[model samples]
Target: MIDNQLGIRKPRGLTAALSILTTYTPGGGRVPYEDEVGSDGLLRYKFQGNPQHYTNAGLRAAFREGVPLIWFFGIQQGVYLPFFPVWIVGVEAEQSQVAVALDEAQRSLPIGGVSSEIERRYSLGITRRRLHQPVFRQRVIQAYESACAMCRLRHRSLLDAAHIIPDRDTRGVPAIANGVSLCKIHHAAYDENILGIRPDYVVEVRADILREIDGPMLKHGLQELHHHALALPRRRADQPDPVLLEERYDRFRTAS
Candidate 1:
């Protein structure tokens, strides 16, 4: 019964079908809103001013020991409503705590739990196609032997499997034909439309970048790649699809 004094408002009908996972208490008052989540999937909550308070330390330990923590949101009508409980799994320090929601099946799937509830409404073929993404990067990286298609950078840690058409697009399939292994720098440039790849696999720097007399990173890392063909996969079928490349290249061209 710690007066954390913050609350998370759940959307209407969010707990309607997932009631089994949610916990409710009547007149629980307001809960704190200071939950900070990171890209690495660690959600942190600091126990206000006295972060090392006994209660905070105890709860942090429980969370790290896999204890389920009920996230209370305040009372609605005569009942205290809370969202689905999350399993506390990590404690970076006595004051900082981390936890993940209890949705094993959904969490294990790709794309941050697109929610089977929502995805069930889509066609089976679409769902099945999207599900293959967990293995998509592996297949693409293997095809390129973990090298960047643009600069032939061989550092696996700095490489990414990029999509010709964004993964969110309806036409973007999780097949090797729609993927290219690129280094982190190239991926960012591609995403920002500062760099583009033609349908014929030739690289192109945005017109503005080509004109800018910048440093070595800009000149050699980007401009030098202009008109150079992407280092394609050894297997012809693993090469990026020309149609998808054309579609994406059009967007990059428009941005440039």
Candidate 2:
């Protein structure tokens, strides 16, 4: 809330584009400039179509003054994730795009560009860890239609995107095919190997858990899911990869 501005679409105190973040082509239409992020931990935001555009000037003002702004990154239709107080770290006038940084470490680097190879590499590593999982979760949840694969629960808040392969593994790319939508309980069970999914897309409960006498959660939530076919996405590409599923399932078998 800079300069008493009522909306985010305007400049704040003539210094910053007040929380400047824009989504393209969901409902309004395609944006003339396509923005992209580089592995260098910098987001190259496309310049405005008009050289004299007020917002472009506003962005320049923000860059000059080192003001903070919010970046509303759209992950899917009707869904946006807000990254607040991001810095206008650099302005590449020749390239017609500006560099934005997501973290303080990156923001503290050189004024015009990425500072050093070591610092940049570290920044990139942190940026990936910060951004990719949330985007991955959104994609996975969208594929599953916001329902849990095990219980078919449709509550959005209860849903989570569980990784088929752990992120530490080389093969654990943040893609829909490498993820599964589960409720919090099932997600915990999957992580603990208390429950597992076969490559065939069938659910399985651990032998000990299956035999144990417990509450309804233990019975219906875990046991009843045994032999149940995991709900899958309609699009084959968005469905979990069987090979990855098998890889993760192996761990579950071992742990169980």
Candidate 3:
């Protein structure tokens, strides 16, 4: 990991070089970066490029074993602010290897008392991953037939399995009944209280949003979505829990 405390700055283009959110780059190769993996399975990333030409072999070993590694982001500058997990999917060359993981797993980390540098970083990373586990998200996505529950947008990239009760809540669990697939736009609107989903699976726009006479984004995106029934999962077992949705909707209504 590059530590900014020692006055060491990260080299350019490093952030674009690694990602866990997508497996393959547009060029169809793995992400390019140099990091060392100890026998204990911890990854120590120091730079963006593998100047020693050992990255290919190391990544190959990781991919072959399905090993997960913690990627440490640069501190102090606030670029790539949080540490997250990554899997080496493919190793194209000494300088090119593909890595992928979920960005959601990197967000909303809780800060607390630290026993050591290692414990502080690793504990939060593990907690964040559990909050947005891939298995939970995939179950909700498949239950919705890979379409937005609100707008029915079928594009997988734009879709997200949003929580009816946010993970910050004590009752929020990574269950299909606590989630809904929504496009990125609608998800943001829902989180901001511009839109709300009722317990009966009906969607509503906030009264203020309904009164706005704006452009296509507002008209089609938020205003026109009032009172639309959510596109539900086929299996009743996978559907959003009415009790949870009602509780969340009550919060939305109060916020509006």
Candidate 4:
């Protein structure tokens, strides 16, 4: 329940940690360093270089320990800078192997642009947990601009970014195209196979549910959603994946 000045509640501890790690490690990078316990009961990490270098190293240490760290970053006049807070998570020296492996993986990634090896490796490491609520919520909100994709509902707190492909099928995997922003009802409807989206971006109601005759409420709600397109993200990169939509809907269409 960590709240930022922007009014966005930190959805999970990992997200807070990732935000802190990325903020402290300028250019979204990480390194490895020594770990110590503080009198406050929080682990204290000693970074190996300047503040930025050490912050990155501490983040890697946190990840290796399977814990999340928190920090802050800011953008001023187009320049990005990070500041690491004193809070830390405790881990043993044996956990350092994970950090070493991450370091080696970062080095092997592509080395240029925002998509550089460091950024990619860091993002991958931070997002590898399926239950990481913050990343999942962020991806969902980003995909639909905090609005419901189906109903165009604008309540930020009520909308969820529903993953077309179940997260358990592949842990910690993220791509903007794999998500849909739906209100709780729509999200549940979607998950239970009651509602599906077509490749052409139309919504489909399952025939069995249509035949239920629960009332005008059900009939109107379900029918209105048919052939309606979803609200999409303003950024092209955040558009829903057509392939995933096709894969899910195509099979449903055949069976129905």
C-alpha TM-score for every candidate: 0.53, 0.71, 0.55, 0.56
Candidate 3 per-residue C-alpha lDDT over 193-250 given as tens digits, one digit per residue, 9 for 90 to 100: 9999999889999998888787999998788889998898777767888999999999
Candidate 3 accuracy as TM-score: 0.55
What is model 4's C-alpha RMSD?
Answer: 12.0
* Per-model lDDT: 0.60, 0.74, 0.59, 0.51
> How much is 26 displaced in model 3, in angstroms?
34
Candidate 3 achieves a global lDDT of 0.59
Q: How many residue pairs of model 4 clash at the backbone? A: 5
Candidate 1 local lDDT, 154-201, one digit each (tens): 989888888888867766666678889999999999989999999999
lDDT of 2 by residue, 132-182 (tens): 676667768887989999899999999999999986676677677789999
Q: lDDT of candidate 4?
A: 0.51
The TM-score that candidate 2 achieves is: 0.71
CA displacement after TM-score superposition, residue 201 of candidate 3 (Å): 0.8
Q: Where does model 2 exceed 4 Å of error? A: 1-61, 92-97, 110-130
| lDDT winner | 2
